[model samples]
Target: MHFLQHLPHFIGLERLDASEIRLTQSVITTLCGLPALRELCLYMPSALARSEGRPFPNVHRLELLDGFPFPTTHDIVAFCNKFPNLRALASSAGYGGLLRDLTRAEESSIFPVLQEYTGTLRNLHIFARRSTLTHITLVDGFLFSRLVAELQGVAALPNITFLSLALITSESSWFDGAQIETLFTLFPNLTELQLTFMPTEPDPQILTWQINGSLDALLSLLPSTLRSISLKLDLSDYHDTRDPDLEDDFSLLFDYPHFPSLRAELMAKCPALTYILFDGYHFLFLWWKTSTSSVWEATADYYADARGPSGAT
Candidate 1:
């Protein structure tokens, strides 16, 4: 074990098809020997539903799977502790839920344990389901309120630097708007952000979100040092949902007056902001098609010059 220790910094345990408890044991053995390991990605099998607490102690980069089989609050908390020094985390689990659950849990809950290692954490990337719930719609106001409060409570992590959130269709509107607001308010040190929304129309229900909040809320929440923003919006409401092969129609949302709030806000609020990219291929196509010829010509010339050899040709 000692001879093979320094082989590499990343250790991936995937598709072993082992049970949760047994897999946990094997993982502990594999990771304990590699004290210097910094990156770890665990792809659990369908049957393996759980793992013991603190699977690793020094991992600086961690990625854990979610979806398919929903990850419970305990599973996430335990995983966080496994990497005490993790500065970057990209997970497929319910990241917002993990944060929310950690907050709502009692003082004796796993959040305190996570707090113990918060100093080493920096970038967090979450990919989970998104809901269409509105701010004014509340099932239990106190529950969500506490979740936000807890997020704000830890928003000031001294070492955190970047955050990326991908909200799927399963989550309510709360994740994109309110949850995002709470996150930015707390973590002012963030320098980069990537927010992606994937709206799906599954069987049994055909729900769509109509966001009433101003895009200003999104811009206002970002830190002053933020430098870039990337949005992937799937606005298919205006299209025929009945058509199985219907392509996403994002034009309606892109033209919304509030859509440019971020750009305007960045220009006004964050002087450090310099780069922006909008993905939503169809939307871009339409934008290019509708733009003035002068503007297009200028952009083409600028790119040509930027990539030309020694300013020639």
Candidate 2:
């Protein structure tokens, strides 16, 4: 509390990360006075039940570290109202555990101009239709059937331009023709996507080869507007397979036989596609120039790009 009192001394402070600081009335009070603060990451306690109504118009991004207990309707709305210019909000895994039975009327009042969000899919509908959320990252993952059921009650989000979904499948449930169309219909403006898949069913009849068979064909069905795509696989559950990077051989999961065709197929299908990536324990990044293509070996810089402002997956 004493240290925070001195914080306002720095008139040019533009970013404040209070993830380790406890949530207190004094903390919020001090933050409200920072006119130049553009980003804030606050650690919220689960017991918080109400909000301080003051507005922070300059803050464009807010992160609720270790997301507090899903707040009540009034509490959540009031909390969001504090940041009128908040364009991006990121929450920890704890935030989206439950569904808030907010009425359409209540949903429309939240996040008036929010454009980017990173949270669970369960809570996406809360802001998707009303807000201009163009960049989204569903950190907790998603299922096609569940998403369909959820979207039935709400409207499709046509403003989404960048999307990242984590998928957990038993057999090979990653790709489907209908799913691709549904995604495009939901986010017609989508240009960048990142997909992460994890296999749950041990010793399933279908192998990685069969999955790629669908991948080769289904990828062609993706929206032509897509310019960059990233795919990551987590295979720790299969046949005592260890981390892919630690393993000497990876032929079982990533096949050398089909790489060329898959790459070529994607390049030709999406004429505007500029970047393609296969990231996991092993990684490969490819980019297309005017008439030629180049490969980027795995590097720390590539990982940063995947999570940077322009690309979030």
Candidate 2 residue 267 C-alpha distance from true site, Å: 2.1
Return the clash pairs for model 2, or none: none
Tens digits of per-residue lDDT, candidate 2, 1-313, equal 6778788686688998877777566666667778889998877734233645367788998888764564555666667667778899898553443446767766666678889989877787777775467898888856676677767765467778899887776664755566766777777777898887765643323535545654755575677788888877666565245443333345344443245567687778777887777755334444434334444322222244443222222
All candidates' TM-scores?
A: 0.46, 0.80
Top-TM-score candidate index: 2
Please give, for residues 102-196, the per-residue lDDT of candidate 1 as tens digits: 44332232212221121111112111100110011011112234444434424344344544444454334334566666666555566666555
> Can you tell me which runs of candidate 2 are displaced by over 4 Å?
45-53, 93-99, 153-156, 202-205, 237-257, 280-285, 288-313
The stretch of ten residues in a row with the least summed lDDT in candidate 2 is 304-313
Query: Candidate 1 versus the native: TM-score?
Result: 0.46
Candidate 1 regions with alpha-carbon error over 4 angstroms: 1-30, 45-55, 66-83, 94-161, 166-189, 197-223, 236-265, 285-313
